[model samples]
Target: MAKYLIKSDATIKAAKPKPAPYRLFDGDGLYLLIRPDGKKWWRLDYTIAGKRKTISIGVYPSTGLSLARDKAKGARALVAANTDPSDARKAAKVKQAEANEAERRVAEGIPLENSFEAVARAWYAKKSSSWVPSHGDKIIRRLERDLFPWLGARPIGEIKPPEILAAVRRIEARGAIETAHRALTNCGQVFRFAVAEGHIESDPTRDLRGALEPVKGGHMAAITEPAKVAELLRAIDAYRGSLIVRCALQLAPLVFVRPGELRKAEWAHIDLDAKEWRFTVTKTDTGHIVPLAPRAVEILREVQALTGRGRYVFPSARTSERPMSDNAILAAMRRMGIAKEEMTGHGFRAMARTILDEVLHFDAHLIEHQLAHAVKDPNGRAYNRTAHLEQRHLMMRLWAGYLETIKAGANVVPLHGRAAA
Candidate 1:
């Protein structure tokens, strides 16, 4: 305890700096400490368990004489209770810092709801770089159309399984059973992302197993029979549309690539001298190499004469600035009297997979690689785009000649199982 002396604001303002550090006591353990540098600090001296300790209350003007006395009175109370006032002050500072951080985050418009749409957009922005442009667009579009309307503003941490199911049931109600499943899968991904990012404690979608209607596992419509394959080839030859569409139809079964990959093929990705078409496949975002058969190269050369100066090999008949519509081949199929149930643009992939594996008797792995399907190596690693290049080149030539023979009405067997050779 000390006698009360310093009190008035005028005395604090008039106090001069000393040659050494000095203190002006108010009462109890409270005092105003002055240094030779002219800075004034309010300090509290206290004892707990008979040990002396000092703590800064604040500064003069910032903490006036009256306020400093009041702080010292509070410190004396804590010390009487066997608690360290310095420790209490530190705790208060920590709480204040936390409050300040939360306020700053709120001011920044950071989502306080941690809503499903908010977290999903963050995840997509982080992940979209790896996806093909159209693939990224499709993902965000799925969220915008399906999930955002219902749960975009709800706090994701509070969302339960039934809420997610209700959202998906809306998709299923429209007979989009497959789309419902896909939407659920996307929701699961977002929920998992939130869990990983610590935005939520758990994913509500984990327990949604068997919640959606079982989707019918149906293959894309394709003509795998040799007679039917020949008839489809004749129909393609007879298709009297744009030359670009005809050439695309002619090359589709030979390359057996996905429709998007074929239509979006850039001229820069093709090198006739190398007899290779190299580009990243949109579906898997992995490199793919299509070995150009002699006939395929011929078609490329003919098309290049027209579209060589542009970006896409098959620049749209409507605009050279863009790739042809994805439905170009499908529309051609329709015009050729091929019903939707009979075939589709994607049917070429199915046809090639069936005929190459069963009829041509090629190695299943090689066929899978040619189809740009994910095929793992002996070490259980996936083969890169150019995997089995020489073998694939040989297979492409043989496949082209096989299609030519079929078109000529030649009855062919599996060449005595000689595909591997």
Candidate 2:
């Protein structure tokens, strides 16, 4: 078919509107529609799927005769190819919109919606609330430090198993084998979340099982022997550091709470008259009652003279507004000639757990409850914080007395019914 029958721009310019809408046919289903209201439009009429359709090419003069014919030719090509021009136009519009959206996301420093970082952040936001604050902090820090720098910008669907393995391998290369494993697990979660959200087909990390080095399991170093325990108690007594940290060191074995719990202890949580310290356990988000032994109360009373007005019982040496530093106890122990393998801040818990059961012969359940562990009932239900408060109170007193005996260089034999005595 011969096209561009409208030879001159002047011919189109001189064509005026008639009393009613009429067409100036330009051949091959292209026409100039002259409206009675003095308006002219370029139109392309086509047939596809045995149905006739019309599409607007442009306005009359602004889209010149040449441009309108070009548009008409493109639409006719689609019809000949068995494709609908209208559908093609709509698809182009959607593609352009997606490009614009991607540009906007990049400009704002936001990840594309299907990018690994984007999905990982969404997953973190949804799940972090259920975790303890410190735990949640660790997870995000792991992603940012280990994974985000490497794999964050990639589309979650396009991330392969090797890319993920390579990212975590950097962490392993730094000797953080455990952290590398954790980073891989976090990536797997984000990938699974993307899959559930329809962004990816499968978790690539699934193919990476057994790819990294296994973490060696070990317990915190602790002084559980009675003689070493006595030596540690005497070393703490002679620690001429800040009075607050000294009291913390003194109370550690008596209460035997986690190092974090001990460092973050608050004055408001203590009831010295009742000989108990009550606070929420950060690890489990459950309430715990520490039956403060008489000796533990004595240490608190001494520290109270200095820090009773502050928020934390063991306030920072440099700033009372915050709790003591996490390293305060460790640093103090290091200064006292205690090796890391000999004892640690967390070792106090293991020390108490072992000695209380083996030497003191306290009931295992009561000791577990005192240790703020998840002690379950006979029916497999978890026991509440105050399950064995009375017995635990007696056990704490006996334990405190036993410590004093050992600290005084006495060969204290562990006797049953010592609590009654």
Q: How many residue pairs clash in all the candidates, one count each?
A: 0, 0
**How much lDDT does each candidate structure score?**
0.87, 0.89
| Cα lDDT for residue 264, candidate 2 | 92
Per-residue CA lDDT of candidate 1, range 150-219, in tens? 8886778889999999999999999989889989999989999999999888888989999999986453
TM-score of each: 0.73, 0.75
User: Candidate 2 residues 1-421, lDDT tens each?
Assistant: 2233566778777778777777778889998887988778999888898898998888978899889989999999999999999999999999899789889999998887678899999999998887757779999999998898899888788889999999999999999998998999999899888888888788889999999998864436899999999999999999999999999999999999999899999999999999999999877889999998889999999999999999999999899998999899999999999998889999998988888888888778888888888989989999998887899999899889999999999997776753331
Q: Number of the top candidate by lDDT? A: 2
For model 1, the superposed segments whose C-alpha errors exceed 4 Å read 2-113, 217-219, 415-418
Model 2 vs. true fold: TM: 0.75
- Alpha-carbon shift of residue 288 in model 2 (angstroms): 2.1
Worst 10 residues of 2 by lDDT: 412-421
Displacement of the residue 85 alpha carbon in candidate 1, Å: 14
